[model samples]
Target: MRLLVTGANGQLGHAIDAALEAKDAPAAYVDCVVDWVDLPDLDISSASAVDAWFVAHEPYDVVVNCAAFTNVDGCEADFAAAFSANALGPMNLARACATGDAALVHVSTDYVFPGTEPGERLETDVPAPISAYGRSKLAGEGLALAANHRTHVVRTAWLYGEGKNFVRTMLRIGEGRDEVTVVDDQLGNPTSAADLAHEILRIALTDDYGVWHCTNEGICSWADLAEAAYEIAGVNCRVRRCSSADWKRMNPQSADRPAFSALKNGHLESTIGNQMRPWREALEDYLR
Candidate 1:
């Protein structure tokens, strides 16, 4: 199979490459041809560029898009740029894939849901995004699904691996600090990018085309995640749990986040059997 991975330098992209190279990687990838591209190599937001690239690299069996405008606060600052990258980018890829007869697997986030409802969200649940980043992602999901029948929109949460992320930030901050403050009101799963990448590959192999939630099992607040990371990494740091409002008070320009945006892998569980491990277990593995 000929595979194309966009945003090739990001955390999930790196993890996908690692997954394909792992000793126990799936047999399906043994004979796969993969192409990694990002930024200057390809601007997915441009429709003409995407079409030309598809024509040049014809017969792509599958295209996995990890590219996204992930800066939440920045999205609020520049919604147009965010929409262009997060929404228009997927639309362009989906259009090209529709014409080329290639399967499109687009990575999304749990922020698409309004966190006011306190429960694990299912794929069937309606998405009412409250923030700019969330709105852009939600739009991307709809656009991709509408533009291509063979599209899989996988939603994940609190991801970390092979790049700058919350866990890495905590580790860096805790190195010289006795205590660090984190938001306790916000709740979601802390997913390992490696685990998510493995599942993405599994999802791409099947014909299950629709919305899917794939995150490490279990949920926790940001403070809880920081404390867990400290404990696992043997860091001497105390977690001062505070509400989201407190966080906003400190960082006035920060974007609003969901209070409870944990996602349930309902589709994955029913279809291919959810393989994502618990958040703490995944975090331990990631840290180690």
Candidate 2:
């Protein structure tokens, strides 16, 4: 199979590469020819560029889109860039794949939902994005699904691996600090990129084409995640839990986040049997 992975240098993209390289990679990936591209290599946001690339390298069996404008605050400041990357990028890929047999696996975030409702969000839940970033992603999701029938929209939350992320920030702060303040109101699953990559591969192998919530099994607040990271890494740091309002007060320019955006892997559970571990277990494995 010929596979295309965009945003090849990002955390989730790197994790997918690692998974394919691992000894335990699925048999389907054993004979797969993978193409990794990012920024200079290929701008997925450009429809002409995407079409040209697809024409140059025809017959891609799978296209995993990990590219996204993930800066939440930056999205609020510049919605155009966010829409171009997050929404238009996926649409371009979907349109390209529409002419072929490639199944598009678009990675999205739980932020698509308004966190005001306190519960684990199901794939069937109606999305009401609050911030520009969320709105862009939601648009991407819709466009991808509409453009291609073989599209899998996988929504995840609080992912961290092989890049600048919350866990890394906590670890860096803990190296010298005795305490760190974290928001306790915002709740979501802290997913490991490795785990998410594994699941994405599994989902790609099947014909289950629709929205799928693929997050770690458990949920927690930002403060809880920070504490867990410090504990797992054996760092001597105390977590000073604060409300979301407190965090917003300190960082006024920050985009508004969902209060409870935990996603339930209902589709995965029903279709392929959810293999995701608990959030803490995944975090421990990642830290190790």
Candidate 3:
């Protein structure tokens, strides 16, 4: 099946690109190769550009939309840009899919839940996003979920990979500095973008058609994940735990963050049987 992966330069999309050709990857994910398209070639934020590309490409079996406006603080500062990239981008892609009779697997986030309480966020749980970024992403999910009626939204969290994540950030701080500080109050699973990409492929192929939550099996605060990172990387650093309020005080946020927003993957497991590896294991593999 021909597949198109958006945001091919991003960690998750690039991982998916590599996994399609990896011999060690699961048989189901190995053979199906994808055509990776980066920003200018297929930027979903530009409807005309995306529509033109769709007209040219004709039909794609799966369009895995990994593209997102992911800067939480930036999103709050610039809601228009966030909505354009996060919400309208998916909407445009979903429209393209409808035009070409294609399927879509839109990746979403766990931030859609309002962090009013502490617990697991089930697939059936009603979303009450607390931040501009989260609200924009939730809008993206809603558009993609409703656009084609055949699309699936895979909500995930705490993504880390080769670069540009909390894990890597902690690794850098631990290696470069004597000590580091991370917020302990916020908790969620550390999802590997590579695993998430493969899971996206699984959902795209299967008959499961709706919003489903997927993430690594365990939970951890930023402090916990950072500590695990330092331990796995064998880097020595004193990690001090602090509250979200303190974190915000140090690094003022444009958006309100969810204190605890772990995704539950029971639906995806039952339907596709491609649950991601444990966060610890994935983190170890990533660090190595």
Candidate 2 per-residue lDDT, tens place, 23-70, comes to 877889998999999998899999999999999995899999999999
Q: Report the number of clashing residue pairs per model.
A: 0, 0, 0
Check candidate 1 and list the clashing pairs: none
What lDDT, from 0 to 1, does candidate 1 have? 0.95
Q: Return the TM-score for each candidate structure.
A: 0.99, 0.98, 0.95
Task: State model 3's lDDT.
Answer: 0.84
Q: How many pairs of residues in model 2 come into backbone collision?
A: 0
lDDT of 3 by residue, 193-286 (tens): 8788677766777767888898988898989998898888899898999898887888775467888898778787677674677899998888
Tens digits of per-residue lDDT, candidate 1, 81-200, equal: 999999999999999999989999999999999999978999999999989999999999999999999999999999999998999999999999999999998999999999999999
Relative to the unseen true structure, what is the C-alpha lDDT of residue 128 in candidate 1, on a scale of 0 to 100? 94
Q: What lDDT does each candidate get?
A: 0.95, 0.95, 0.84
Given candidate 3, what's the lDDT at residue 152?
86
Ten-residue region with minimum lDDT total, candidate 3: 24-33
